[model samples]
Target: MVRIVPFAVEQWMDEYETWAKYNIAETCSASISIDDLRSLSDDPSRDPLSTSTKLTYGAIRGSQTLRSHIARLYAPPTGDDSSTTVSAENVLITPGAIQANFLLLYTLIQPGDHVVCHYPTYQQLYSVPESLGADVSLWKTSGEDGWKLDLEELKAMVRPSTKMIIVNNPQNPTGAFISQEVLAGIIDIARQSSIYVLCDEVYRPLFHSLDKTEWPPSLLSLGYDRSIVTGSMSKVFSLAGIRLGWIASLHRSIIEDCAAARDYTTISVSQVDDRIATFALDPLHAGKLLDRNLQLAKRNLGILKGFIDAHRDTCDWVVPRAGTTAFIRFSRDGRPVDDVALCQMLQDSKGVMLVPGRRCFGEEFKGYVRIGYVAETEVLETGLRELGEFLKAEYASVPLI
Candidate 1:
């Protein structure tokens, strides 16, 4: 029947994102206004913005200038930009990271292929492969052990038939990441198996500076010949509205294949989006934009931490090392709370939106919820207070299980 169910998380967000008074369910850092892109574009050094961006179907090959801007982000040794960081040849523009991943899965995996993916992932990572008839294995993350990937499981799961391994770094929902050491280990496993590793590196540079984790380079830069990195302006860049993304690969074949497949889908990014994205990625403005977003997220994270601390008897979380969201488990006396019901009630009554763990990590994690720390500071504070009040009135007396 080819039933591809609605992406539960995105569907949930769609239903309530606009309904919420305090929208903490958002994954992007607040939202970027057109003025935000203009601020970056106003840089005197780069050529001025061209208002005459033709409304035609645009270039399937994408803008060379934009590709160059993206290429520079993946400076080589760690990035695949072999000739001076990365060349335009190595990039294939997509509508967003979601589409970038779709292209990779659509083009690379064949029916009956073996695919291993890090779980608690963006649903598409596994779902697309499953729909393609791939035998998929999950590499579970240990929230108790700090939401780290089980590299040992990766070792045990891959077989002679394994075709690819997928990962999301500065992962969605949990915000856990694979460090360079972890990256090296996974790369070695892929190399030994002679399989490609597709890393969803959309959350780069969101690394918590105060914490030990430093901002790491994309897997494309990490010296793996077959490593394919998918990234976008959506995450740390706070530009989901732009819908700009790309795939970076050392292997020319992957880029070519994805570009070819794209012809059947979105065809090309809108010219206006390409121009705005180019400006945002300009060297002088990129750091400032990233800094602005990181500051907003960190401030909200502090508020979230305080909320979590106040509810210590009922909840706990492995603090995220990077990115905007964290997966938190809340229970009533050591027993799992009905996370779906709790989230639904919170949204329906208090107008606070949060994604339930079931949407991200599957049924086994239904006791958890994904909280995003990227809204306006005041909104974040109020949302936490409302949530705290609800918890107090409802589950306060429940014994810690």
Candidate 2:
């Protein structure tokens, strides 16, 4: 009897992704096979899967090797080591980042608690908290100004009953990144209020478009013990098939509470998944895998940029600073086009599937569409080529909202 709103983005994908010829709607960094993972390793002879290892319920929390790797992600860059290092005990592995997000929300939120969440993000960030009977306030950001969140506005939204503040970095649909200064500001506010800050950082470290100096560290690394970050091998590592992710926090109590709540939902993730995730995150392979993906993201993003530039008259966007998605708006004669109709017609006619912004994200996003642009180079090129043809031939007919 939990009357939760349907997860529109997920439902849309489930409905139309099956027969998509050019799956440009996918958000992962072009999924890779186990063999492909091995190829990236300096020692290609080592197999990712342990052939003789018997499958059991594995570690209740997670394998030590996997947890260690996940912990290492929060450590400061090589030359900039910090006193606040995360240990294996500080991490709890889950089936995916989705489960990690859900488990944390379920453990923390209660009826009548006020929650502030970043808007225009993956719906689960706000929707899950709302379903838990919490009063959720959306901290809105706009595409016109590059999806920037104003810190002063966030301060105004906080209430005495506020228990948590949630955010998504390298946000979904828009792909705008939060800067270091803004992140510090958010932490300062949360710390003063004694509120928990949960950051869904599933798309992190894939900052293909940012310069080295512009790269921001993980939220957990900001020296805030109340901070919780969830990440996975799905996005940056391109290993969605493994379905491995983790919840990390410097606060032992937070990790302990999540682990307790996790007992009913998941005793342990698949043993095979644990092994694969460990191998994928191994230092020998992780760097190479990231390098391959970073190159692909940079290349495909250029192709997407070309398409945007060529069709500037009809389409406009806040070019993504990181992550795989881009939010673009389409208009005809100075009026917003019907995004649902445009998406359906494009997918049905040309097989270039896309998520309609108005239907999936919110009604206010009238003519917007979310494009996962970090697909393989050839797929993006072909899809955009076909999309260009669709725009030229079919755009005029797309009714304005």
Candidate 3:
């Protein structure tokens, strides 16, 4: 008999494409075009005259140049470096960050292995491991405390069977960052237990401002040979269409295992895609793109914050310090609203879509919603106005519990 998957796949199937106003995808707002990418790949001196000819399966472990560029992101400064330096040998490119995550889970987790993860965070981090028959436990983060992970609670949940701890910094829905202190505490716990740490660093360097706050140092940078850092071009470079991502690890053994597992799934990424990704990694180009995105996110976040403040009685948010989305709690007279019903009503009435928090966390976060504000300025402003009007009308009609 075939064993069925243990995770909730049905919940995401229909909802994935339903929310975009332009089929609004709050998951990733970055846009990339074929023409734009081709411009980056032009090399007059090279013998290849056409882009289509370069479409063959490129490198099994990704192009050396591409891997070198990715490594630079985590490399230590040239002289008297305090941080660890990463090499191309330590990196393995994958289809996207999501695929890299799956590869890690498949490689590290076995049927009886136990994994600890922070909740009200990315669903895939826990779900994938659970599906593989790993015993998964949640360490909850409180919204009232700015969604900060409770180190004490984490300490309490550790078991001898625990094999790994998963973290998403500048967290998805809440946008709560894991501070250096919290990261150090976690590292200490992991080191004591010898548990591997899998950190999803896809949102690194997307901070609101370089001066606003110091982001957590990479677990790899901490010199923990067991730690794995996964990242992608989707969020930072605004090139999700290229579908380029990678996993970096100081541990040679884990890197080998992930590569072996990857052989069966993808073998290698597309050649043209890899070439364009390399071009996009040019320091000057990347710096300009990141700066533009940061400015846009800052402006849009302000618009969202002002809107939320105006409707404080109906909604409240902790205000994300980073990332593309924010989570908001909805309630009336201290009684929480049904998020599924609210989401459906808002979508049907105002053509605005918000991901229900039930999908992000478990049942406890039902009254919350994740909203994306990284769209064009006019779109962000208009979407919020529509949402506010819809909430007002709904509140006026429904009886307060």
Q: Model 2, residue 22: displacement in angstroms? A: 0.7
* Candidate 2 minimal-lDDT segment of 10 residues: 75-84
Best-first order by lDDT: 2, 1, 3
- Write one digit per residue (lDDT tens) for candidate 2, span 1-401: 56699999999999999989888989999999988877876765688888899888989999999999889888887887663799999999999999999999999999899999998999999999899999999999999888999999999999999999999997898989999999999999999989999999999988889997999889988889899999998999998888888999999999999999999999899999998889988888888888888899999998899999999999999989899899999998899999999999999889999999999999999999999988888899999999999999999988899
- Superposed Cα deviation of residue 194, candidate 2 (Å): 0.4
lDDT of 1 by residue, 1-401 (tens): 45465688888888878889888878888777766666675555554357666588777767898898888888754434443345788999999989999889999998889999998878999988888888999888878788788778889999888999999987888988788788889999899878999999888868864463355667876777888999999987778987999998988888988888888887679888887788788787788888888888777787888888888987899988788888998887568788887888788778888898875569888579898888778888889888888787865543332
Worst lDDT 10-window in candidate 1: 76-85
Task: List candidate 1 stretches off by more than 4 Å.
Answer: 41-49, 76-84, 209-213, 396-401
lDDT of 1 at 396: 51
Give lDDT tens digits, candidate 3, residues 1-401. Answer: 22335333236436654554632335454465655544543453432124456466778999898898888888654563777788898999999998999899989998899999988777789888888888999988888788888889889988999999999876787877788788889989999989999999887767773464375667777887789989998886777878989999999888899999999999799887787777777664566666767888889888988998899898888888887878888888787787767776777777777777775467788688787677667877877888878877775543322
Give me the overall lDDT of model 3: 0.78
- Indicate whether candidate 1 or candidate 2 has the larger lDDT: 2
- Lowest-lDDT window of 10 residues in candidate 3? 1-10
Backbone clash total for model 1 is: 9
